[model samples]
Target: AQSVAQPEDQVNVAEGNPLTVKCTYSVSGNPYLFWYVQYPNRGLQFLLKYITGDNLVKGSYGFEAEFNKSQTSFHLKKPSALVSDSALYFCAVRDKNAGNYQLIWGAGTKLIIKP
Candidate 1:
């Protein structure tokens, strides 16, 4: 079984400052991790993925994440925060051992950027 954990319920950052949203996962084998963002009344939007390769992966809206296998962490990062970047962030993991292909979603973290 694979699972994702988002320890933070909310992350507050000032505009133009760097922001990060923490995530951790547990899996049997290698984990397939992903990050998504959701706005009010909108569906989750794909941000980035870590299937393999580089530890650092970049994604939409100037977001990037570091895939730390040893720590079982995939923390999302932004060089600079924006007021528009305030949204709900989710971390998800794919269970390779599961028969059905479904993502185990994390409890979302609300990112609040103050100007």
Candidate 2:
């Protein structure tokens, strides 16, 4: 069984400041982690993924995340935030144990950027 956790229901940040959205996971073996963002009334847009390779991965819209094996964390980050960046972010994990390819998703984190 695999699972994802996004502790914060919302994150508040001032425009131009750095923002971070935390995520953690639990899986039997190595996990395939992903990040997605959803606007007001749109579908989940693929942000980035950690299939393998370097721990730090860069994704769409200046977003990046660091994969920590020991801590089992993949926290999303952006050096500079923008008002347009406000949206609902999600962290998901593909459980290899499951016969079907279904993503175990986190509850969600609503990011609010203040100008």
**C-alpha lDDT score of every prediction, in listed order:** 0.95, 0.96
Model 1 alpha-carbon miss at residue 42, Å: 0.9
Tens digit of lDDT per residue, candidate 1, span 1-115? Answer: 5788999999999999999999999988778899999999999999999999999999999999999999999999999999999999999998677766788999999999999
> What 10-residue stretch in candidate 2 is worst by lDDT?
93-102
Decoy 1 TM-score against native: 0.96
Q: Write the per-residue lDDT of candidate 2 for residues 73-107, one digit (tens) a residue.
A: 99999999999999999999986777678899999
Q: Which regions of candidate 2 deviate over 4 angstroms?
A: none
**Which pairs clash in the backbone of model 1?**
none
